[model samples]
Target: MVKGCSLSQNGSSSFPDPLLYRQLVGRLLYLTNTRLDISFVVQQLSQFMASPMINHHKTLTRVLRYLRGNPGQCLYYPENSPLHIKAFSDSDWATCPDTHKSISGYCTFLEDSLISWKSKKQTTISRSSSETKYRALALASCEIQWVTFILEDFQLHYTQPALLYYDNNSVRYIATNGVFHERTKHIKIDCHVVRECLQKKLFHLLPISTHD
Candidate 1:
């Protein structure tokens, strides 16, 4: 999807073949298991499956073209990988122009090999970007815990705190500074998983450049 571009059910002619659109999108959904690059775009297009529009079809075609042009792109797991856990989580606040809801995404890596990831729309309306980032971080924390369980099953464990990168400094303060809690009262209590994880040494928060 184009940066700053928002798609909606309005202002477009409906696609002529809804079934074909659905089929193509279903294939794209399956491909997301390996083609992580297209996950966000597939999520956007899937929203209009019931009433797909011409613009949606055009976007889907572009994704397909990109995939065809880069068939070699795929998940690669290298040999002799170390037992390291790291993750990156982010959110686009109020990205859905029609609903004003946010989208959160996170991807985890074990020794530089991608393992788990997700892209989903937030259920509640977020009043601020900080709240959205907190939500995304909370979800990513849970995913990291799940990955830890898998590692334990292999008789392995990450001795160091999992490095979690986010693009917001406020989030780091919220998780690290107790005084920061007073300012974050507006944020929901459930969104403070980062704080708990930090105290328990489950993960270490790091600021990352948005462009990265």
Candidate 2:
């Protein structure tokens, strides 16, 4: 909702003070831990805290009203799920306006329950959709490593290869194959790391329809 804010101010005197505006934005950001739906909205509001106007305040208030109307909303997980680990990853190609950096997002699940998730902008620009997907896969692999260690701590063993699902077929092929395409040479480390995981039989990559 904060993304709907318009920077309309009648005059300079009508604008809210920067410090107070930032303080409010900070509080909203803190609330995002239990409210994942508000993360995108909070992040948008934070960007305009420096010189907020009445229009920006309107947008912020709308977000607050939304929360007030849905106070009981919370993430719930069911027990008695299977022990198998699975992950899904994807990347938006050059979604950022300023840097042309892609955003990598992945969600890990232990059966029906979501165990881990991440949404981060890539540090470098990717030249192809396959490269964007590769970066996302690398991030998902790191998450799998961490989760595997935690499971080992509990004396639970995952004998089967950890399943990683990707919607992009090109990236899946690249992961299963050792040869690198010309477009992917820029991120050689990512290619090597994913290839190594495949060889070690630590994880398995699978293709899933985008609809899934």
Question: Which candidate number would show the highest TM-score if scored against the true structure?
Answer: 1
The residue pairs that clash in candidate 1, if any, are none
**Segments in model 1 whose C-alpha atoms lie over 4 Å from true places:** 209-212
Pairs of colliding residues, candidate 2? none
> How high is the lDDT of residue 173 in model 1?
74
- By summed lDDT, the worst window of 10 consecutive residues in model 1 runs over 186-195
Candidate 2 lDDT, 26-110, residue by residue in tens: 9988887667677656765675666776666777788889989999987678857667789988877875554677878788888
Prediction 2 global C-alpha lDDT: 0.76
Best by lDDT: 1
